[model samples]
Target chain A: MTGLMRRWLAHAIFALAAFATPLLLSGNRYFAFIAGITFFSVLWATGMNLLYGYTGLMPLMFGGIAGISAYVTIGLSANGWSFWLAMLVGSVAASLVGIVLGLPALRLRGFYFTLCSLVIQTVITLAFVYFVNLTNGDVGISHIPLPELPGGRQLAGTAYELVLATIAVIGVVVLTVIVESSFGRRLTAIREDDGLAETLGINVTRQKLAAFFVASLFASVGGALYAPYVGFISPRSFDVLLSLNIWVMVAFGGRGTIWGPVIGAVILAPVPFVLQDYYTIKDVVYGLLIIGVVVLLPGGIVGGVKRKGRADAPAAVAKQAAPVR
Target chain B: MSDTTLIILLSTITTGLMLGLIFSLVAVGVTIIYGSIWMPNAANGQFFLLAALFAWSTSVSWGLQPALAALLVIGSSVPLSYALEILLVRRFYDVPNRNISYFVLTLGITQILSGIFSITYGVWSDQFQLPPLVPGVTMLGPFPIANNRLAAMLIAAVLLAILFALLRFHRYGRALRAVFQNRDAAALRGVNVRGIYRMSFVLGNAVIFAGGVLFACAYSFDLTIAWTMAITAFAIMIIGGPGSVLGALVIGIVFGLTQAVASIFASPTIAAFAYLGAMLIILLFRPSGLFAR
Candidate 1:
């Protein structure tokens, strides 16, 4: 099957699973919420993968960028803008900030690049927390109006889930295109060797900045959508931990693979909900799992599977020889 | 200036010193690991938190003296930290693109430890009162000073002095330094690079563990405190060049002082932002840090 067909099948299955989740599982509202959240998180991590996995730039500013977008969307909506417009503005803001941040990062590399990202994360979070006049700080903005559909069809509960799923589908599709374009190949080449890429006529700086902007765009959109879905916003929600989670998603999934982060999100996002009652054990288990996966799988879940598949012999012969092997 | 304002400034500066000393202790751990093994060890903050948790449990449960408790925390933590070095960190030394994994691993360990602590300790935010170690208050004429602050300062000073002295005089310290300056050369000269790496990781975390004990003794602690404080320490480690012990100390103290001073005139939240703002400015101007060389 073609790549497009594979993606469509995956998207259809995902949507079916998402819709069927809340309906089939009684008293699993928490699980349903997480399932929906997984979709958004997948988008966020994929954004991270574009920069980190493809471009080899570790942008730890995902949470901060997301926070900026979330706050902007919520802040604008408070001034009477529609929800979708607010989200759009949030994405633009994140992109602009991405450009601003990317400018400085152009000269820096390795630890320095990481440090710059850290500084951005810190500054953005601080602005959100202390800019109380606008952001409402720790108290955070609430009662974010749900998007209005035709015929005055108001979104709540399952209805809101449907809406977010549609947006998430659009985001994944758009991102897929971006990932398959010449830009994506450039990013991967840049990651492999920036010096060599530059020698070969690639504009390394521009590519890095472009990757940063694109990643930030997705992160901001994810964050904005997250605000209304959760029905609240706080600095606490978008802390460094969330940033780390984005890293974890990319790492645990196959980093460069287009669908890796989404798969990771699907598996990992629901674990907390599944282990909700044992919250304390949850983090420890989560940490152990990440370490275990990295150490054992090396190339992550998809990477490991692909390796195994390649190593397998001819199917007809291998079937008979499997036990011996 | 008014006497009240003057006193406030003096006290805030003093508090900043105490906070800075604690931060320096933690930053040193990250720095030492980076210095000796060339790894960021982002979980430095988590180790500090763990040490605080352990310190609190030991002090409250065993009714041990604060000095003994600090020592006990350090003693037990050293082996555990070294074990972590062997089991997890050792594998990553040769791998090319595993720094993010290292970050993720440390962060994962941090969260897990935090979760375990919250569960076992029940997340009740408690201040460990070491009345004997940190008494009530002392008067320096008109300037009344809390004994707790005074004791923290004294302890920090003594510990820092000892650390510097050890780094200068000890065989292990010299070996570690040799490794830091050139790992291959040091290894060629029979430095036992692997052994040095193990020792550095332990010492690095020991400092962090000690810092945590000092932090717990100074004020209050909850499960989230270390994680909250780690970001500030990250700023310090970056502001100060990585692998520079003196840089860590100086930058941490400066950061602490700035935060304390900001807290007086501005809201506490604004003070936190000021640290981040300062970090951004530093990154813009000198990406290598205040003293990268």
Candidate 2:
């Protein structure tokens, strides 16, 4: 009955559904594959939420970071290393790169930082394509071998889906823990006003870099798993659009809320697959959705609902006090 | 110099001038909009592509002269930008942190435009080229340049000169610069801030459209040019200071020359890396840009 208990219960239910969906759709591999992909989206959106929601930085290079990990992981695995070890190294290396890329965020705020990140994303994609021998160029590496298990069995089918589900659930739990921690409070403070947070004794630069490292881990880990799961890896796979799509998920779900991005990922992830036949119109629909979220639902679905509940809040008070032009 | 070196040197110069002029045009367009409204138009590349595509359709498919088609495309951007300003852009002018919202909004526009292009133009042909506006080759020393490309380069240069003159001497230009310096202060000086916003949006987009049409005239293009040009234009804008037209011109030319010269020794992809590396360095050392005034 307590709020804490209720929150935990919600998470538990979410985990159960995540695990159950794969088993439920195991009879149809197509649907199960979609579920697995949705899990990746959930993990990605949650990572994005940490930076975008809590830290107020919308990194358009998120997918590029993921691609960095994916490429590194794939390259290392091809050279006679274990996939697990490769993934670990790839994630850390990508995270380090992410911190370097995020150095601009220390000085630039809001739109400038976003533009800088956009440039970084473009460079990352170009690197993926230019390094042909490593990434196999625009042709992309296909038939990527699946990760191996401890029992010498390949991780595939229902087991892979379960693992993905578990990862997604863990991602959500990790995000929730971070959100409730003192570090989360610092991030929130910085997001609200970095200058004010600095005046209040928050080390804005260090906190931001730490946040980048943690968030990049989320992106890179999912990316490392993504290559083998999809059985392919391409520069196109982790380009700006992917980053935008994940950002869209977070923004649409209600950034700054724990459950919002997960809900957004669940609803929006399978949309392209479901509308596969109408592929031409798919992007148009997404475009309209992005515009709609910006124009009509700036706070997003969850945030909009929360705002309505607090209709008499300070925002309204401030609006009332403004002089009529 | 040997014949091959002579050829490479001439080609680099010619290519650099043509590409540099076009890059300056587009970067100027982006800077005006960003300088005025603080809205970093992510879809500026899409706007550029739209102009190119429209020119291709009119000149090649509709049988209009290339010059006429270019004019039509540039003129058409006026109404298109007006509609967009009134419908979408005007709504965000007063919002705090409007730049981020505008960025996201234009990205939506980008998605729509790219998606539409993929279906319509993508199905038509993988590549598109407009017919030469003038037939013949212009010999400059040992290098034979296509008359059409030469003409495109001249027109781009003229446009840049005219743009510089307008911004430097014209009343509208002064007002625009005023708004760029301080929006609130500009308003205090009896300048209609909203009207200036609308004008700059339309003018900026019109310049971008001109860049696109001119690019089409100079070379054959595909849909992929949109993203490439977008990144290149942004790099120029960043290095040149967001609101400085002079900065855009200088940095744009430098970038174009760098790309042309680098491609001579290495792959074209390496040229991209070089400019991008330069932009990153500039961003790190001078976030305000090389020409911030």
Candidate 3:
């Protein structure tokens, strides 16, 4: 089969699974809730993959962006705005924050930019906690109302799962288009060599800003979705560890690809939920899986699989086998 | 200035300098590892925690003198660092994105170690004491200071001074400088590059281990403080210009001072916000230092 056909078939399988998941759980609201959260994880991690996997910019502050947007959406919803409208405002604000941070930050090179991202995480979380009147301090804004399901009904249980799963699937499709476009080529080129890409008149900095803006939009949207799904929102929910976990997911599933981060989130996001009864095992297994994936499969599942498919292309395989420092 | 304002300024500056010295001590540890290994060790925090744990265990749990616990951390952590380099870090040394890969590995290590420590030590514990080693007032001219702070600061300064001298004068120091200049060239010069990598990792960790002991004694900390210290140290190292020891010390002190001074005018959380903001400004605007490339 051609690459296009393979992708479509995969998406077909994914959509079917997503739609069937609520039914598969069979009235287990807890599992259903966990699945709903998983959908959001996939969304956020894939959004992160767009920047880190393809663009070579590692954002440790994506969680804070997500938190900020969630807070905005919640604060608006408390004042009685439509859930979708609140979400929209929240996402746009997140993207604006993205642009502000990226414009100054993208000027720095490599890990220096990464350190700045860490500071972003610190400063934003601090802002969340410090601005008590705005963010409700550490107590966090609560009772975020459920989103309307477009047909004038509030979503709950399987309805929530189905909506989130559908949206997540749609997000993956959009991301697929993005990664396969000319813009995607430019992203990879910049990742490989910023100087050479700039020499080719690609305007590397502007492209970076655009990518960061979109990435933040996706993350903040996930945050916007989160408040309603869980019916409460807190600053503690989005922290540095969450950002670190998203990076791990992207890396594990495979960077520079559409499905890797989704696959990563799908596989790993549910572990802790399922293992809720096993705290010790949960932490150990989580840490072990992370270490095992990096040490054992440096290219992640996507890169490993792609390397096999491109057996005839030695140089490409070598390059894909390990990203250069 | 009013007496209240003057006192606040003096106390904040004094506290900032002390905390900054401790931060500098930690950042210099990070700097040495980055310089020698060419990979940023995010797992450096784990070493800090381990050192603190060991120190705490030796003195508080085992009921040893604080001085012995201080020696114990240096002794234990050196081997631990060397072992980690061999088992976890060595394999990724030559790969593409080795630095990042190692960074991820260190993150993994942090989680694993955190898990183990949480299991063993139960999240937060009232660990050993080193400050009470000199429990009283120390007069520094007209300003009376905590004897704990004075003692810890003196030890930290001496240790840092010793490290500087080692790098400046020792044979290993020469070999390390050579490795930093060009890994391939130093290897070609029969400099035992692998040995340097192992030794630098150990030596870097050992100092932090000792510093961690001192820091734990000097300040009251919980388990999660390791993560904060690591980030603050990274901020220090980056502002100092990555591989520069002097830069690490200077920047670490600056950050500590920033945090201390900010706290005087606002609540600590707000002070933390201000400190992070200042670090962000410095990180973005003035990345290069007296010694950063």
Winning candidate number (lDDT): 2
> How good is the docking of model 3, by CAPRI class?
medium
- Full candidate order by DockQ, most accurate first: 2, 1, 3
**lDDT, candidate 2, residue A278?**
97
| lDDT values, one for every candidate | 0.76, 0.92, 0.80
| TM of chain B vs. native, candidate 1 | 0.90
Instruction: Kindly list the per-residue Cα lDDT of model 2 for residues A1-325, writing each as its tens digit.
Output: 6988886998999999999999999999999999999999999999999999999999999999999999999899999899999999999999999999889989888987888788889899998898888899999999999999898999999999999999999999999999889999899999989999999999999999999999999999999999999998889999999999999999999999989999999999999999999999888989998998899889888888777755758566455532111
> How would you encode candidate 2's per-residue C-alpha lDDT over B99-157 as one tens digit per residue?
99999999999999999999888764478989997889988878899999999999999
- On residues A28-100, what C-alpha lDDT tens digit does candidate 3 reach at each position? 8888878888899888888999889888888888999999899888888778888889899988998898888
Per-candidate count of clashing residue pairs (backbone under 3 Å): 0, 0, 2
lDDT of 3 at B56: 78
What TM-score quantifies how close candidate 3 is to the native fold? 0.91
Q: What local lDDT score does residue A17 receive in model 2, on the 0 to 100 scale?
A: 99
True contacts kept of 3: 0.54
Model 2: lDDT to the true structure? 0.92
Instruction: For candidate 3, please provide the TM-score of chain A on its own.
Output: 0.90
CAPRI docking class of candidate 2: medium
Regions of candidate 3 where Cα sits further than 4 Å from its true position: A1-7, A149-152, A309-325, B1-14, B123-131, B139-144
RMSD of each: 4.3, 3.2, 3.3
- Tell me the TM-score for chain B of model 3: 0.89
B43-138 per-residue lDDT for model 1 (tens digits) = 777788778878877787888887788789989987797678778889987676555567666766777777677777774565444434566888
